[model samples]
Target: MTDSTYQFTRAITRRPAASVVNGLRAEDIGTPDLEQMLKDHAHYVATLKSTGADVIELPPLDGFPDALFVEDTALCLPKGAVLMRPGAPSRMGEVAQMAPTLRSTYSEVREITGPGHIEGGDILVTGREILVGRSARTDAEGVRELTAIVSDWGYRLREVFTPEGVLHFKTDCSLLDGETILSTERLDASGCFEGYRVIHTAPGEEACANTIRFNNLVLMPAGFPKTADILGKAGFEVVEINNGECAKLDGGMSCLSLRF
Candidate 1:
């Protein structure tokens, strides 16, 4: 199937000032106004449809408060959906809820079980390769196991390490197309998969790393003016929405939905 023919699911959530994780204490950060956050999420959903995407909503899962933004821990592809084992134990329940939603849209759905944990945010699928990150959130075991399972799909799996303070791979890098990638300046250029044309973003604009491509349009967070300009210069029709609240919870444009 072509990349443009896939479907996606996005869950809208109430703004949470802090995220709780096992071993790690909850982090408090200044957040966007609740009303604005809701508005932003709504706009994001609407934008997805406007761009000719098939959008669905996953029924909210209790206990897993972060399940609303479904994309953080799962990825949808032509063959099947990969239900990731989130590194944050607090977010593990998300995969269970995600599996059913994926099944509704695609016939095959699978899970990445582990001695290693993986997060959807750490995995990037290009036309020819799957880039998995070795981060505090994703482990080598998960990478090895998931790679083995996806080998049949003809995707070459490559690994990249998330810089110490960067929590997820997608937080530092996003595949824009088969050849272009949007990445943070902090990532070591030598470590990226060879042959990718890298577009480096300014330091604070790293949030730009979280972009979703549907057809020819790139969906991204609205607040980063410079990043949007950069994408525009690259000939992409960039669609930006304010995801300030989601960002406060360590989420970004791509985190709001699971696109098949």
Candidate 2:
């Protein structure tokens, strides 16, 4: 009763760890405000549930400062789920911690082992083909391993290099639908999403490109009003959630959880 056109009937999220103030990021943004973050996360969960997904909340991994950004740990494909080998050594343990839960939800659970480093943030599954970002966080070996894992499922893998200054390919692009991709100009110009209608985020609001399209609703980070207006003009309903804390850590809506 949960699965639908969204291809996601459930969402797995872990509470923000108190030690997140010490988490990793490209820049040294000030520490996050925990109280506000809690409120924001609550709203995020409520909004996701409004889309009809069963939200699975996992306990905070106090030992891992960046565990809240669980999306980097694994990826959930229609056929099954794949436990990743995070590029960040500090984040490597998160994949193992998430595997048990993934195994219970997916019919088949696979993993990227050894020298392979695969973060879900560097991966985009379009139901038909898989786009793997060749970024600092994702290597060719990891992409090759994932390709092998999904090759039997009729999913072809496309490799694209992440633009400089972008932490991940998804940091500047996201699929709005099968034929459309919401992205920043810099990313769209990379010719990454050829064949898909590319909708560029409003000027000065490039971060808005990292959105989560659930069913018919678009879960976008708040404070990007201009970008939200653009999406609205594109005929998509936008639900905004304040992610100040996550933003401080270079996280976004898609980074908070794994949906499948």
Candidate 3:
């Protein structure tokens, strides 16, 4: 509805813990290097703060390997924040760990207490509505429950489908602006973004699809020169962060923080 979607005044991020080496992944690529992840994470936070926004850096959660991927824990909006119910049993506790911070940040907060599960990664909030894809981490019942909760706030929720084997809906797409989406060809072919301007990642650079547009800059994973060139040509200020370590854990720029 408002520019709060990308023009955020604040963001919440958690530092990666040593146990991040054991973070969940769709497949085992290689163990993530905590040292490298920390370095990249610092660069990320610093970049966010550079935009003159308040960035809250929460401490690491060693007990929870995927805690650094804070975006999966909640869906933050201008109206309020909704805590998600992750389908991953090991990741369910991450929601509770993120609750107190959100409760303190927003005047109103809601939770998805349900028989179904949904993770924030499966949701994409645009200027018009909320698009949620049913994935391994998100289900039909969870989408129905989320719709009911956000409906009270005058938000419309649309149910969509994640490509087979994708870890999350956002693994293949991201909003670059109110009406522009940066996506992979496979995901775009699904026709979900028909009404929006879609920018396909380079043929072999689909890994760069999971980026974030925060304020004046677009933070994307490094190593995708073609996509970066395309984004620059499109007038987006791009910042490339080395994602070698996080990539091993199936994480990207969007997973690092909760913007609002």
The lDDT-based order of candidates, best leading, equals 3, 2, 1
RMSD of each: 3.4, 2.0, 0.6
Clash pairs of candidate 2? none
Q: Write the per-residue lDDT of candidate 1 for residues 103-149, one digit (tens) a residue.
A: 77668777887878888888888766788888888999989888987
Query: Judged by lDDT against the true structure, how good is candidate 1?
Result: 0.71
RMSD of 1: 3.4
Query: Residues 162-239, candidate 2, lDDT per residue (tens digit)?
Result: 998789888898877776778899988888888778899999999778888887788999999989998999998999
Which number leads on TM-score? 3
Candidate 1, residue 112: Cα displacement in angstroms equals 1.7
Full ranking by TM-score: 3, 2, 1
TM-score of each: 0.87, 0.96, 0.99
Residues 155-233 of candidate 3: C-alpha lDDT, one tens digit per residue = 9999999999888999999999999999999999999998999999999999999999999999999999999999999
